[model samples]
Target: MDALPRAAPRPHLPAGALGLGALLVLAYGIVPLTGTSYLFEALLTPFLALALAGLGLNLLTGYAGLLSLGSAAFMAVGAYAAFNLSLRLPGLPLPASLLLAGFVAALAGLAAGLPALRLRGFYLAVSTLAVQFFVAWALNRIGWISDDSPSGVITAPRLVVAGLSFDDPRGRYLVSLTVVTLLTLVAWRLVSSPTGRNLVAIRDNETAARLVGVKVARTKLLAFAASSFVIGIAGALWAFAYLRTVEPAGFNLDRSFQILFIVIIGGLGTLRGAFLGAGFIVVLPLLLARLGAALLGDGFDSGTLEMVQRIVLGALIVALLIREPAGLAALLDRAGRRLGRRAA
Candidate 1:
């Protein structure tokens, strides 16, 4: 038989890409089909939002070595900006409102980062605190943002897109998934690019980065802007998708600390760290509550359980920082290598 021309070899996807695709299938298809409605509304949706917030903080603090205590402030900016845009501009699309909200938050980050040029260490951290206080105050005091509601709590408008309504928990969860996936891809592209290298260099040693002709000031500003932009989108998701309402109290100092802990515990400078850390933070409480109930039964009061949870969480943070400063990502990586070696 005449040899037919060989067909072109099928292109294989990178393992990372294949793994990511499989994860997406699991999240979007399998989870929706098998997971409970309460899980979608209470756990997964909020986890995605918090994870995205951790990713944003990771960019600024992890990659760029900037210290911030007001991550929640930027979130507030995005949430309120998105809320206002969607409310006033009836013609604007929901995604457009979200993008614009991100821009607004970016501006706020730039303003907060201005003093970072001259400040360092504790001083810089304090400067970011100003942003946190200012945003909380504005969101609460500014009646305009809340549309003059007496309670300062406003319900998110219906999620209607292209004549489809995503008003239900499942639909909202899907939206959160889509947003996180897109932003994560963006973060990967950024860290893989020249800008990412600059961020790392600056983080390691600002003086050396500047000596190497890196625009130290510009890079810092860029880091802040990019970080805030992602965080802002997360805020929008938190408000519109997870919380389903805009409240000043939602993005508070405690919330900022939560996000910081997520980055710290998840593993600095690693993207997957955000997700891992968020899962830990979100699931740990439930686990502890269950454990307490199982062990102590009615003797373990809910209030006592909450207090114990916080104490255990603090102790774990200290232990992790001292023992595995690289975060859970490093630990997982080590385990994977060990398994591979054993298999070999």
Candidate 2:
């Protein structure tokens, strides 16, 4: 029998980017059709928001080589800014408020990042941590942001845009998908532009970048501003679409570290890594808990299972870093290239 004719390879974008885009389309387009509200709301929505936050951090830490530990603070600024704006001006649209919140966060990022411009490495990181503590304190101390709630918790404003209310799970998921998609596209372009090249230069060697007229200081601040803008939007989405509640405790130091871990575990300086890392962060523990319950049945306690999950997660992160420091995105790229060669 004659062998089947070899199929021609179709031209495409980078495999990682194309594959991720397709996966997102499937997630938003088809996942809800399965009628799994838990996956959509409890998992995917938060995953997208966190991924957006990771992407923002990747821009600053991964691409620009700026060390930051105040991502959650920027997020808090975004959330509280949106909360106050929406509260003060009830007539504002939700989408508009989110955008404005992002800008406000950008301003805050510029302020916090300016002083740290003279610092580098560990000092820069430590400087950013001050923003985290200050923002958290401000949120609790400022009654206007929380509306003086006795519990110090505030509910998110109603999510309404153009006569559409995203109160339901599917609606929220769609909103998140739309926002993330657009922002991802913008980030992709930004990273490929001249600005991104300067960031790379600054990251590699600040002196060299300055010698070559990169305007190192200005670029560093811009990186922070751009990163904060995106993170701020993510924060708003996390509160308005995912959690539907805001408290200073929710955006703590741990939250900042979680975003950092996502960037590290996903693959630094790459767009696809953000989503990959978020999937790992969001799905791994849930899988572990299910496995524990299946194995231990009724004998398993929630606290013990959670502890086990943390241990496993830490071990896996260590293993992955030791094995492939570039993270899962690099692994997938390698796999895709091999398959393409085989197909050829």
Candidate 3:
């Protein structure tokens, strides 16, 4: 008797950029077909918006050593700006409107960041609170911003692009996927360039960065602008794709806090952490509700479950800080290394 010859080893597929591109193609091409409305509406859309928000905040806080409590304020600026641009300019494309909206948001960010020159840490954070309050007040009191909507809540217009309407969940999801992917790539490129190094330099030591010929003031402002641009787009997506409305009250201090939490929980100065943290934040509440119903049966109540979810979330955040200060991305890297060792 003779042993059968083993089949030739399977060829390994491409990795790195090519592999990542393929994964993205798979996600964009297949996910919508297989996913439901709930998946798009309840999870992916919100996650993309929040993750993008986290990414923007990380650029300023994690890399540029600036603090902000006015993220949602910038978002409102983007949302309302886009709304107004598209509303007034009937011939303009939605994407163009959104782009202009981002610029508006960046300008607003620049204003909010002005106080950073004389402030840092908690003081900087407090100064940004002024931006938040002012933005909220303006949106509420200014009828022009809302187009004089009776309720002061401006519902998003048709999510149309290239004559295709992105009014449904599937369409909205695709829009978000495209926008988030492109922006994430841009962010990666920015962070990989010399500007990113300057940011890191500033983050490490302001005086040292200045001594080394880095224009600390200019760099900080540019960082704020770039971050605000991304966040502004995220804001547009939040209103147009997820919430489908631009209400000042809706994007309040809590929204800014949530974005901040996402950055902290995801990990500072890491792009992957943004998405990972957002996934956790968006999915946790739904998961908690499902688990509560499953375990507690019919006795569980919505209000009670909401409280439990918050408690659990707080506890988990504390545990994560204590156990892995670097956040979920660090945990993932550790796990991957362990698995690779076993595989080898």
Candidate 4:
């Protein structure tokens, strides 16, 4: 067989820009080590976890052209899987439990992908929705999942590694950052590989990919499995680092939609978009809410604040789509080119 043509190289930030970014992150990590700021540490963990999940979802929807609405289900699977692993393998460490959880979620993702062989478009989206609901219902029905409790919540045990406890917010934040960074690097590598090219080909045109001997169905399934595995690990981290409790409600449709929105607003086909999008989703609301409260004072209620937030979010999405459908990354790229031209 002849070799496939190489894909165009991805546009990356300049080395100087990358160095600066790394320095900033290093500062963030080192500053907390001096003394913990519970608020900043607590906020950073969830932000990183959600961003990781968004990156996984972007791999499927943005790169592979597979629309998945059951991401939250995979997340739920990871959380429960971790819970069960912890209980069943009492001697196993937290890291091992997290890995097992990701594996379990990947299996679930593979099972969910089986239907994609025959489904597409709205049908495919609906089928994934079934996975979401079914997993949620199953979690509710099983007493073991709930630990025979009425509320059906699973609290993560304290993370003790090599005699060091990550119970403190600072320790947890560092762990989460490390996990996120490693997973993001892995995702970056995966997207630059041959398999990633196949996914993009499948996404751009399935019929053309088949003509080139790409196994369209198999590739799609692989994409889903890989995407879900990453998402599942992110969910486990979320449960352990942020929530410390897992419930079915935590992995609802809204969660899936939120991830989708992040990809759409950040940039559909890029990893950097995932981080930018997650930051927007997580940070913007809080900022807006605070601004709203300051303006509305005691007259504002929670319902009103929520309504305003939705309106603002919807408006921003529409504006971004209309002005720069390629998302924030595109805008940044254009700006960078302009600056370069001016300098030259």
Q: What is the lDDT of residue 114 in candidate 1?
A: 96
- For candidate 1, the clash count comes to 0
Q: How good is model 3 by TM-score?
A: 0.93
lDDT of 1 at 150: 72
lDDT score of model 4?
A: 0.84
Superposition error at 74 for model 4 (Å)? 0.5
- Candidate order by TM-score, highest to lowest? 1, 3, 2, 4
Task: Give lDDT tens digits, candidate 2, residues 178-282.
Answer: 888888888887887789889989999999999998988889999999999999999988888899977889999999999999999998888888989999999
Model 3 clash pairs are none
TM-score against truth, every candidate:
0.94, 0.93, 0.93, 0.92
lDDT of each: 0.89, 0.87, 0.87, 0.84
**What digit string (tens of lDDT, one per residue) describes model 4 on residues 34-93?**
745655454577788888898889888889988999999999888888888888788888
Report backbone clashes per prediction: 0, 0, 0, 0
**Highest-lDDT candidate:** 1
Model 4 scores a TM of 0.92
Q: Give the alpha carbon lDDT tens digit for every residue of 28-79 in model 3.
A: 9888889999999999999999999889988998778788888898888888
* Residue range 1-344, candidate 1, lDDT tens digits: 55443322211112367777899999988998888889999799999999999999999998889989999999999998998999899888888898899999999999999988999878999999999999888877889988998757878888877788998889899889999999998987787678988999999999999999999999899999999999999999999998986678889999999999999999888888898899999999988998999999999998998899999999999998898998988877778779999999
